[model samples]
Target chain A: MDRSNAMPTVLHAPISPADIAPFKIGDVVYISGVLYTARDKAHDRMLADPHLPFSLQDACIYHSGPLIVKEGDTYRVVSAGPTTSARMNAQTPSIVKQGVTAIIGKGGMSQEVARSFAGRCMYLAFTGGCGMLAREKIVEVLDVYYAELGATEAVWKLKVLNFGPLLVAIDSRGDSIYETVRARSHERLLRLIAERKRAL
Target chain B: MPSHREAFILHVAQALQEAETRLPRDVTRALANAAKVESNDRAKEQICTILENVKLAGAAGLPMCQDTGVPIFFVEIGREANIDFGLKEALATAVQRATDAVPLRKHAVYPLTRRSCDEPLFDMICDVSEGNRLSVAVLVKGAGSENVSALAMLEPLQDVRPFVLNTIWESGGKPCPPIIVGLGIGSTFDGCARLAKRTLLRSLEEDQSPFEAEILEQINELGIGPMGLGGDTTALRVFVEEAPCHTAMLPVAVAVQCWADRKARFSIKL
Candidate 1:
């Protein structure tokens, strides 16, 4: 494990799937390296064919289909905000086990995925709709892996800066912010309804 | 005819861009009032900050919100109007330009591959009504609140209160607090969904139907509050739009618009 840059509050990792397994809840992580973008269709394809197009070992997967503009030889990311993570719930565990280090997306993931990948990979929630801000951190768009997927769904290798202001929602210990919030909200809602009924 | 087409397209585009640039007047006022009425200090402060940010963004010509949203256009075209240009194409072109010009965030996703690293702006839906005068309403829906939207078809005899309340409860803090609930009732499943989307475009300050007004009061009484932190103002407003439906089914669709509630409308004659 690389401890040279790890701080008590946040850890700096060359971030790979292997490195993600040991992270605990509330651990702030600054991922500064390459990550790939994929959303619905890409997930479907990867699922249909057990053989992934590229090696995902120790890599972070971002649930985003960024706006890009092509230059002479490279592509520039205009906005690369994270999409809702819940949409990818079914495919998460499978992708996580494929050696994904961390998952970056908005909203929350499904309970099954959270439980299955608990202690194996961490899920980080990014602020939704901050595409331009997210793009600012990208140093370069390394390469486009799947052109057929079009710009939004293609897997593009992105090199990032202090790339994230991510919240540690799901830790290696199986803790999930989504689950906690949902349970609490449900209880509060029932109480509110009950009170209203009593008053009626 | 061409002139009318040009006028319609240009006016609609300009209206949408201007709305995108400026904060909705009612929203600005409501947030201020909400801040004053809110008892929770933290939620009050949050509302104040959000209002301030909106003002600053508008003044500086920055996006009102980070999520400019997928540009959804609801157009009512007059049957007698002789428009030479293709309305859909014109709107699409305007959107593409706005995506770059207003520098609106591109929120459109390609259905397959989900690889939208480029060409971010895409049309989500467009509804056209034939008429003599064209009325276009543009609503820019952000992903945060949209992610929490829900729809359910109830038995004709079943009460809808439970379904609506449960959906709102499930939404929690994800949609951002103090949301506007757009309820579409009485249509087919898909029609109701579209009605729900269209309802968000209605002005918050306008007087609603009597039944809807009563429902709105009840919904706000839910106490979901700002950011779901718990307070008196769970929902800012509720708009219900209905269409005639079969007696056997009751389709209900709920679309939640966050505090941002970005929308604008314009009309043109050809």
Candidate 2:
């Protein structure tokens, strides 16, 4: 893996099916544009609501519960990093159906989520716990929805500029680096356990 | 003028702020070393970004991670110490102050209702020490790692290796590797968890026991890598804390901690 050969592919959001089709697992990406924050609570609430305050058409959803604070009339993002996407696995297929083209999160989503990305969606993984780095990329807090769910759980609409260095862990073609890694690890785990037992 | 208790509370708040904003030297050094050893490009990128985030967070005096995490305090009180004020109340007050001052995100909520709570959320563990000083160490634990921490009571004959490996396997990237695996072996169920959690407070620079070193080697062999994306480094270190347990029980607790490994400590004589 020559680090120099793999420069990050930067995609501006409102990303379309065409925009994401070429990305494959192991490719690096950087996103710049509108990103909405939605954690577990916000996902459930959004799906349950018939009339959403915003549209998901060609949107990029960030699986994050940022540490944001309000100073007078404006909201400040102190830190904003991706939360585990697997936790949102149950809701993601439906979210993709709603037209979310790119899901920016950390960790990996389920194989079902990979299936959901068959033609239109992709999962970009920002390094988990790099909130400060993420915050630095977020240029503005455009607006917020579901404020009633409290600071951490609410939906925050944000404008970001080159908010990445994210890895394409799952892609539109129904392939996933996570699944590959998981299968390999499980096999190793079984072998290790078997060897330990044999030594006994 | 502020009283001694007030001063102590202020000290705790500062420590919390310090822990939240900066990556401790041991943790930072470990991550840097891991980054150098990573063979996978994606894994290397993640580790580099994490190092950059740590630097930015410290420079700006902002939290290194958004989930400023639940503050768990390990308080060591000397036997000869005398406390005129309520230590628990002071600690709670310090948490609230730190929450506001460090601007810690409010993470407390009523469990069943899922409604946010006004009071600060924290946990404290106290133990007696030899001196007349009160030493408090705060471990800032994020939900990603904390959620995956597991406790199992295996039969006395059962092997501990499989349980630890399985826990890490199931956790995958959810706990955010390269992580720290703190193993507590041979204690009561609850005590095992405490023992495991406490191991995280130790400096990563400390020498690992032979058993700890063996488990760590096995874990990295799984190649879950950084963020489980298939790399050479899945976990940076594994710390084991063992205790005597019931004859029939072989309790094991795996306390997973993310790379952030945020923590700070302060000691005061009263």
Candidate 3:
């Protein structure tokens, strides 16, 4: 836990199984290189469409709805930050199976999602709602897919640099920080209610 | 003529951008206080990150959150307002202008078809007021919190506190704590939702009712902390708005709001 000695890991895409293996639950990471943006709608589309324009192998997917502007013919990222990943739970396990090595989002996923890690995938959460911070880390947006799915839910191929302080909420071995906190909080909630008796 | 339409459009656009990028004074103060009180290291770290993010977003002139949320307008129109132009059209135009100006994510989708809306997009709620002045408040609420907001019709004798607690517990980290829980007790089921949603517009500096204060204390004690990581700041504030209900029903609505809590308001005289 010594901050001065332990430098954070900086990951670049296409991230390999080996590149992410050293990360565990609670290790903070910074990601650079090629990352993809896909939320609920894009997830569904990618799962259904066999002819996905981009490959999913070793891909790092970010759940984001970037505020982007079109300047002449190019797109500029104005704000890029993570969205809640819990909503994508149903599709996440399958997406991981498709060889996604890392998933970046805010809020953690479920037990089922943790199970999908299978010692080969990890879930990284950035500062929720910190779009400006995230956007600054994004160096360029390479290409966009499914542009029709509205801005938030579309697929964005982005080139990033040091895209973190990403806390590893779920690690490759199927361990989850969320579940740990949930159990602890639930116990506290009960004790607090019992002490107060909800009398007021 | 003060060019009401044009001025109002500009006002709305500015408000939208401000709401998207900035946390209101009361919200920031609440967060600062929360950080001071949080004992859990992880929870404190999360709160600090949020505060730091706010500063970074402001410096960069970018949205504080990537979701940018669904832009919702609460419009209060005066009784003697002379409306030579269409208010709805003007508001819509304002939304488009803000969309391009703020560069808000075009996330609107047709409910049934899931197809996207092409132009400046946002939702609005209109209410009539007594004066000749027009006031509009804009709130940028992200889906993370919206997805957890719920309405329930409980038995007349059932206590509302249990249901509210359960909602927060079940939501866990999904709504992006530390969040504000806006409770609407009494009124019809749908009306309760409206009440709860409206309560979010109130400033955190407003006087807290006794019930609200008690709930706030207990919610923090739940130790959901910031981002549900376990701490004493699970919720920064609890706001309750109530209305009369029928003789045999107890309706409750919980509107979960994320820490972003971005809001901006404008009042203009016609």
Docking class of 2: high
Q: Candidates' TM-scores? A: 0.74, 0.98, 0.94
Model 3, residue B262: displacement in angstroms?
A: 1.3
- Where does the lowest 10-residue lDDT sum fall in candidate 3 chain B? B221-230
The better-scoring model by DockQ among 1 and 3 is: 3
Candidate 3 residue-wise lDDT, A75-193, digit = tens: 99888878888889999999999999999988889999999888779999886788888887889889999987866778999999988888888999988888988888788667766
Q: What class would a CAPRI assessor give candidate 1's docking?
A: incorrect
Stretches of candidate 3 off by over 4 Å are: A1-4, A190-200, B1-3
- Candidate 1 lDDT tens digits, A1-200: 55338663333434654566666644555677777888877777766766666777777788887778676887766556677677788888888777776788766677788887756678886655445557667898988766676666678788887776565778766787667656765776577567656765
Ranking by lDDT: 2, 3, 1
Q: Sort every candidate by TM-score, greatest first.
A: 2, 3, 1
Q: What is the TM-score of chain A alone in each candidate?
A: 0.88, 0.96, 0.95
Candidates sorted by DockQ, descending order?
Answer: 2, 3, 1
Minimum summed lDDT over a 10-residue window in model 1 chain A is located at: A8-17
- Residue B72, model 2: lDDT of 94
Model 1 TM-score (2 dp): 0.74
Q: Per-candidate DockQ versus the true complex? A: 0.14, 0.90, 0.69
Per TM-score, the best of the predicted structures is 2
> Considering every candidate listed, which one attains the maximal lDDT?
2
Off by over 4 Å in 2: A1-8, B1-3
- Can you give the lDDT of residue B3 in candidate 3? 53
Candidate with the greatest DockQ versus the true structure: 2
